[model samples]
Target: MSNTETSPQGSQPDTPGPHSPEPPDAAPKARGLLRSSALVGLMTMLSRVMGLIRDVVVANYFGAGSSADAFFVAFKIPNFLRRLFAEGAFSQAFVPVLSEYRSLKDLAAVKHLVDRVAGSLGLVLIVVTLLGVLGAPVLAAIFAPGFYMNDPLRYGLAVDMLRFTFPYLLLISLTALAGSILNSYERFAVPAFTPVLLNLSLIGAAIWMQPLFQQPVMALAIGVLIAGSAQLLFQLPFLWRIQLLPAPTLGFRDEGVRRILKLMIPALFGVSVSQINLLLDTLLASFLQTGSVSWLYYSDRLAELPLGVFGIAIATVILPSLSRRHAEKSTEHFSRTLDWAMRMVLLIGLPAAMALLVLAEPLIATLFHYGEMADRDVTMAAMSLRAYACGLLAFMLIKVLAPGYFSRQDTKTPVKIGIVAMVVNMVLNLILIWPLAHAGLALATTLSAFLNAGLLLRGLLKEGVFTWQSGWFKWLLQVGVANLAMIGFLLLLAGSAEQWLRFDMWQRVSHMAVLVGGGATVYLLVLLITGMRLRHLRH
Candidate 1:
């Protein structure tokens, strides 16, 4: 047995530091996840803050009318492909392979693999962008057929805007490749901060270009191009620092390149399930009302704050590590590592979900109530945010668990589960759209996510993918208990805050302060009282 995987081929060992005390029971060390998640969170905060600035400009410049909605549709097309090819599908396949390469005894082959894959993916993304730019109208029709059917003006605008943003597919896809590279090296700060560059670029474009363009939508499209370019170019320095500055051989003969292609083919389909689910959600939302798409978009933006910052950071960091351990046949180490990652995600993700659901209104009201966003928009957005929160835990779990499959090169399993969830989401959308309106989209997404997470977990268990210490359930129960205690205080505090209605800005601020302060106090107290003590932080 290799030292890392003596327990089970897929198991992870507990990470222990020389100075750390032993846990009362065997535990997975999650310090790396914590450090990485927190760093990603801090950086994401900056990005989201900038993103909000960009949105504020958008909302003020183009409210939830046909125009804003049209522009968003154009924007999302390239974005959908970006997630599918670059960040979502490509990275899942790339990370593990790169990790395996890094772990290999042969360094020369590793360098060849990296250069060849970089050259190949770069070429592919460029070609995809060209095709998308050329076929923008056709692509727009697929996503928003209802619009093209109803209004030629809107349809034409969607095509124009799509042309401007199609390059985003190339930039962000390559950025994802760069990020996967940096993440594999454990030098995560650059990739974590890269999106902030995009957000900032948009914010600048929003401010400066508002007066430049004859139409605000044109300005927004230009901003998207600038932002996409910024995100891509920003990662180059870091790539050089890591000596991953590619010479671009584009060699098809490399065994590692061939292996990645073989794996990515299946994983790409798996990734399409998640992205297609969103596109499906958008299509169904379009049939409801003009504003429906934006509402879901805004809520999803909020939910992803936690998911992107923590869930993604951990998933990215651990996949490579897990891949290496499994390759070494370190069964115990693999299971232990998986246990630690799952536990940490559960412990942190559960609380964030609860807090979001509880504080949905205040958060929306605070962050988005300015500019052209009215109180009514806040209410609808908040409602959708709460609904999205219902599945925040599932989203994070999928982020963590999907990596487990990817690490072991089981891309087809996630693809299978993802397709099942997409089917569930599509069916629910068709059935519920008339009844619940946009809210149905949110609810359907949440339900489908749960279905996806459940399937992944079932697959893992059946395969004995990762064994946990016997007290896994007990740990979950403890987290649940602490969150329940936190919820009680939130209910009471929210009720009290509701009393201060007709108030000045300071009064509103004070009310928010009290609600935030009191709820946070209760949450921390409950955790401390229960001896949580960041128990999962060791790894």
Candidate 2:
């Protein structure tokens, strides 16, 4: 359970090395943290790229119609479950406890804890998956009731597809368990890379298996099940190498397992507020005009690229590190790590948000204006994409800040904040949905994210868990100037959404590439000119 890996700049106590021995005086090192985060970010970047391709394939085939709407809703159910249980509450609760066991106990104890958790989690997931499958029709009504009333065929199809997708919840949750253990060991790459398997499976299904299915979208559901299994299987060897492979045993009463379950109960709500908000968006979108679901799906995917790559990558790396800091009673280092993460979020998230906002229409036009995707669909999706873009920074901030509480085994505070955010989202949804339609749902979600992030930050400060570092004002000024410069550069080169729609596929792709590349170049150049350096990026 100990990390023996040496750091590039000599070994740190918390530096994770496969099959390495622990050093008693090991401290959390900046270089080590950065390395872990970069590795996860790069792998996530690849997965997001593949995910984009998968979306493109789906758009080309199904477009934003009833069929696409049905599949998106079907897929969203299992995926929402996966994120909520596997990556959201479960990971947050499990990792901190697991990290404590590893840091404070022996290898045997750690392995014992793993076995009990795996067994308990596995048993519950199996039961949930069965229920989800059996209740697919009921779920279809609950998630997309508009379909049952106005479009029975789509409703029926969603129910059928969900039966295939529901099993993914069980498989991916177990996969998440494996990934969480690896993260505790500081082996971040394998888990980060696991998502690429899903993207590839969906892409292959869309390209190859879709033609074989009587209803095309069923192929994607099957692909999801296959990907779930592959991702779970892929983590086994890594776990074995680390010698923490579980020998399953029912551990409902196991002390460590009980602790995790206790933590997870509130975390279920605390850690997944964003996902819950998004699910609400999907539910509301269902009652909107047809194609609303698909438009939101596409727009959300674009916003998620940066969120997944930088935001999630940072959150994933920090949780285990923060857990280790907490276990070691290293309050100062913990504060520093949290501060570093927040700074990184601002540095990367600000520019990413600006770029998404500036290039929303061009990006949608370039990516999805294809066979089944009409010009109108492109316009609708871009509208929501911009709406989602508005919350990109807030979304990223929540990813890091929530972990600040979760790593400390403090779940109740976040739950309170989450409830407030959820209420605000619902109210804003009703207020905004009437005027902006599908885009309004996206806007409500964005606004709620700000509320969530702000509350989390306040909680951390009130508890004295984090102290503001000096020079924040100057740092913000630097980021603000760089973003303004990038926005100006993009605006000068930008064309109207209609003009973007007029271009052919190759032309659209080429023009978008130039805009993206040029924007990134300008942002980086402005940062450098403002006296920000590579070293300043490190904590």
Candidate that would win on TM-score? 2
- lDDT per residue (tens digit) for residues 1-539 in model 1: 01111222211223222322433123223335566666666766677767766676677667666777788899889888888778877888887887776655344555577789889988887888899999988998889887878768777888999999889888788788878887766556677778877777666776787678776677778888888778778877666655566667787777877878878888876655656777887876766666777877777777888787777767766787787677777878777777777887887788788888987767666555556666677678777888889998888888888878888888888888887898889998878777788887788888898898888888888899776666776677777888898788777676432333334456666777887677667777876776667644556
Give model 2 RMSD, 1 decimal: 2.9
lDDT, candidate 2, equals 0.88
After superposing candidate 1, which stretches have Cα over 4 Å from the reference? 1-31, 495-510
RMSD of each: 6.3, 2.9
Candidate 2 residue 130 C-alpha distance from true site, Å: 0.8
Reference-based TM-score, model 2: 0.96
Model 2 scores worst on lDDT over the 10 consecutive residues at 3-12
**Which residue pairs in candidate 2 collide?**
4-20, 5-17, 13-26, 13-27
lDDT of 2 by residue, 1-539 (tens): 12334234321235333423656335445346677788789889999999999999989988999989998999999889889888898999999998887777667788899999999999999999999999999999999988988889999999999999889999999999999988887778888888899999999998999999899989989999999999999988778877777888899999998999899889988888899999999999888999999999999999999999999999999998888788888899889889999999999998898888888889998888999999999889989999999999999999999989999999999999999999999999999999999999999999999999999999899999899888899999999999999999999998898899889999898998888999999999999999999888765
Model 1 TM? 0.90
TM-score per model over all chains: 0.90, 0.96
